[model samples]
Target chain A: MNALLEAQGLHLRFGAVRALDDVALSIWPGEVVAIVGESGSGKSSLLRVLAGMQRADAGQVLYRDAAGATHSILDASDAALRRLMRSDWGFVHQNARDALRMEVSAGGNVGERLMAAGNRHYGNIREVAAHWLERVEMDPARIDETPKNFSGGMQQRLQIARTLVTSPRLVFMDEPTGGLDVSVQAKLLDLIRGLVADLGLAVLLVTHDIAAARLLAHRIMVMRHGQVVEEGLTDRVLDDPRHPYTQLLVSSVLAA
Target chain B: MIVLHTEALAKSFTLHLQGGVSIPVLRDVELTLRAGECVALAGPSGAGKSTLMRCLYGNYGADSGRILLRHEGAMIDIAAADARVMRAVRRDTLGYVSQFLRVIPRVPTLDIVAEPMRARGVAPDEARARAAALLTRLNMPPALHGLPPATFSGGEQQRVNLARGFAAGHPVLLLDEPTASLDAANAEVVIALIAEAKAAGCAIIGIFHDTAVRQRVADRLFQILPVYEPA
Candidate 1:
């Protein structure tokens, strides 16, 4: 199958820092690819560039739609990019509060996404919001409550609900379970894994924790100094790392 | 000794707009709760489970019932208690986590969770510290602690509500759908918190729709069937 998304020779920089250098990757439909590296290794910058949240200095990021039309994310108009973000793509932030509206009710937050897709009926919108809340393991009774009333885990869960409510074909997640307790992270990983399998979504995930990547990603890309040093099947990479850096990364996690 | 007991609790509503139609929600319910007891109420939707909890919490008036509570060396009937007495009971003896969180806007979540302890005359610093501890255990991010919960997601709001209710260590606690909005991980934390509360000798009455949660926390089960009468 043709890849659902592809990035070729992508490059980005911040002053003297080369945030991403000649990064190239592809994600097939119903696949999960995780980008793993240490802090400032350019994994996040690469993800941001691919997700169209940041502009790259050079390279092409192409998304092949379900209809087989390839669209260049960098060349797409702002309105077109916004529509894609609202309808066909999702981004899950490490800090959920940054992605959610702090002043809106829980129902309003989810319902707004539906409204953006042209749903206008109040009853219908609220019903879908409630359904998404329950799907995310949240109580629908607090639909009128705000995100500020929620704990970190619940906020993250709600953020997932908000993003997935539209059933986007592709999702970009940045450390979805970071800053959570070990036990909480474990459960969240299970939820994410289940949802990804059920929805058949193509996902590009960025995380420093190898365990999370191992659990959720089908393919793993190890990055160092703004370049992908190694890439392969998740189990293969973890079980037998060819790159020395990949070996060190895996061993460091085990040592910790 | 039973810390709380309800004798033949009954409730009905008259819908005047619907031509005075009488709807009986609860019928002659009897329950007994001892210290360190956790009882889960299980029932279908519209089965008066929440109505019974509301009645137990003194949020709804009972047409006929005896909600007796052992509070501060006195056995008080919450169903018949005056507003002032009920307020005192709620302040010092009862803690409730309703289906939704209701609060004034602009009060920070930390202070909101700390209010129960503050009401019991605990020092602000100590109460806040305890509140922070509970919030952390529930996996509430520290960055949002200073902000108000008025704009929080349903699940996040529920955690703050749970933290506030659990903070006080009230003698008699009522929880309605306590874990309904939480994921397995956060839900497990709540289970542990409930266990700790039970160990501390609190008497709990809760409605848990999640069977797993009920299985982990409940010592016994109470069934509330929907009450219907001849039209």
Candidate 2:
């Protein structure tokens, strides 16, 4: 039971602000670990650092591949990282506009990841892309439509389909349901939960919404001032928060 | 064989805003359940019945003692189980039916009931067929199966919740006033469901305020006494 991803002693600073302070976390295979806090709490920074998109001032990020070899993600060559991202890892951005190729058709957007993974058969790529679209509850008829014409929730679903089409074992999701209508967010969260379980994905999820975390995460880490104030089982942390900051954060969510 | 038990379980709530006043709800409470038995939690108001239920469900952290249940052929103390173990245990061994239906908005009733089965790796077609069968048994019309339960009446919503809870068919089940919102006929359906579950060797714990319902379904009564004290 080796950790799929592990980070230790992470410290990142921007001028006078400590973006991440001695943060440490691990995600096991097929596990969903949520990092939650208010804005500027460094949750997003930790996700980015763990995903190898951003460098921490000091820390060790270890990733164990399926072949049982552990690699230092922070020190990996850019080429190696790119190959890893295309094959073994997936990232879903908060804004679909940031993750999606707005000009590409939905099917092309999903097929690009397959192409990067070395799937050269055009018919197979299109078929797999259409299957992924259906898996995410999108209409296959819209596969030729560019994402720009889709609504916000539909675009996010398309982004998820594109990121997941290659069957990445580990995913880094930063506010996957952010900026959607409340009803849409709930539906999207349910879809994500089902897909994560179906695919057995190990996820590093960064979200400010406690309810979403409760619904999707197995464990929860509460951050404040770039430090983890509390971490435990999702229900335990939400129901019996030991840290004052975590308690305040949990209590502040308005009841729906 | 015993399916679940609690040993000297204790729980208390501290009010942070009320000058940190501590309210003891349960203290040294011991309870047990056997396969094919229904234990009804009986007590007056504020007697910690719901607290004990929540503790067993891992919604509330126990202050002390063990809430142990047989999971995967081993007696695991849920009070100390980590999130991963707890999730697995809940997925494979424990089931709960609360008084109301709480589901993601816009998820149709059939999918809501079938989702748990789908998570357990059941095929979509079979899971929906089972969910449809259960909902039909509970008198939910097929016309409403494609609609969400958000706008349903209280009794109708509870039926949906019950169907979802029972669809998983875990070895142990917890019912928190499951029939509180149901009519007499619906309550009868629930009694039958409980009987069928027990016949299949599922251990159950329930809180039923309706004495008739309790007498009909409960094999025994576990009384929970209040532990409140004035400061």
Candidate 3:
């Protein structure tokens, strides 16, 4: 099967820094590709390029949503890109504060996505947002409250609910479990893994934790200094060390 | 080791916009959070997550019940604490990150982050240096530090908020849903930094919706209930 979202020979730079250089990868339908890297390794730059926030200095990101429509993310106009983001693609940020409009309540945050997709009925929006909130382990009462009142974990969940409420086809998540504690992280990862599997949505997850990649990704790609050092099935890469960086990452969690 | 406590913590809003009408945003709620542990409050739209946080932070007073803060050598009855006490606690012991850009309009980014230090009477030169270090940790560009934060991107603005919240050396940090706008990669960077801060012994309280974010950082979790109908 052809890859749903594919990148070829991608390169991005900011004066002295080569954020992404000659990077290539692909994701088939319902695939989870974990991009792992250390700090300053261009993990985010790659996601940004794929999301069409920053125009790539070189290369292309080819993506196809569930409806079998394909487009180049980097080539679309602002309106076209916005429409796609609103309807087909959902981006989950690491921080709940940035992903939501703080000025509005939690219901508004989730409802805005629905409105963007043309759901104007307040009653319907509330019902859908409530259901998603519960799935993400949130109470419906806090929907009127801004994320300010809740804990860090809840904010991230709200962000997920806001996007997933629309049932997006592809989600780009950057370190979904970065700041959360172990128990909460466990429950959340379980939720995400289950949700993705059930919905069959393709996901691109970015994280630095090898364990996270092992647990959530179908395949893992290790990035160092703005380029992919190694890429393969998660279990295979974990079982046999191919790249030096991969070696360092996997050995840390070894049973022996 | 409890840093903040809410007993029967209840709040309500009376938005009399249309001919003596009232809106009860929150209702009977109770919460207690200890130091060194992160907690997540999960709820749907109108569930009162933000309302609870604001009431705790003293953004708005709860209509009834009591909010208590217990710190080393200082215990506060948050409900009755005067503005002076609140200011002192907020300055020396509290760090807050709201969902939106909370920085002063047109203020240089450096000053915004370093505002806490300046508030605590730190020297101007030293505060600037502290701001620089925090900004660097958050991956903010050095050159952008001198400009007013209003011109910065949403990510940078939030970074500035985080910097300001932490720069004060406050023991308890409060964040209102900090990562709803960033792409995945930048989101990771911010969340990782929050973890580092917590490990450094800052009592961090954050509001978030991303399950992964909550699961990764929270030590305890609560579901803040809301009153669907206002009386």
Instruction: Compute fnat per model.
Output: 0.00, 0.44, 0.00
lDDT of 3 at B33: 75
Off by over 4 Å in 3: A254-256, B1-231
- Residue by residue across A78-159, what tens digits does model 1's lDDT show? 8888988988899999999888998999999899988998889999999999999998889999999999999888899999
Error of 1 at A183 (Å): 1.5
Which lDDT tens digits does candidate 1 get at residues B1-231? 699889999988654445556788999999899999999988899999988887787766778979999989788898887544666788899999987887544569998898789878899899999999999999998887899897889999999999999999898899999888888899999999999999999999999888878898999999999987966
Chain A TM per prediction: 0.97, 0.99, 0.94
Which portions of model 2 miss their true places by more than 4 Å?
A57-59, A102-107, A130-155, A180-187
Q: For model 2 chain B, where is the 10-residue window of minimal lDDT? A: B13-22
How many clashing residue pairs appear in each of the predictions shown? Answer: 18, 0, 60
Error of 2 at A11 (Å): 3.3
DockQ by candidate, in order: 0.01, 0.40, 0.01
lDDT per model, in order?
A: 0.87, 0.92, 0.78
Q: What is the lDDT of candidate 2?
A: 0.92
lDDT (Cα, tens digit) per residue for candidate 3, span B100-213: 774443458887787679868899899999999988877888999989887778878887887787788777878788777666776787678777777777777777888788
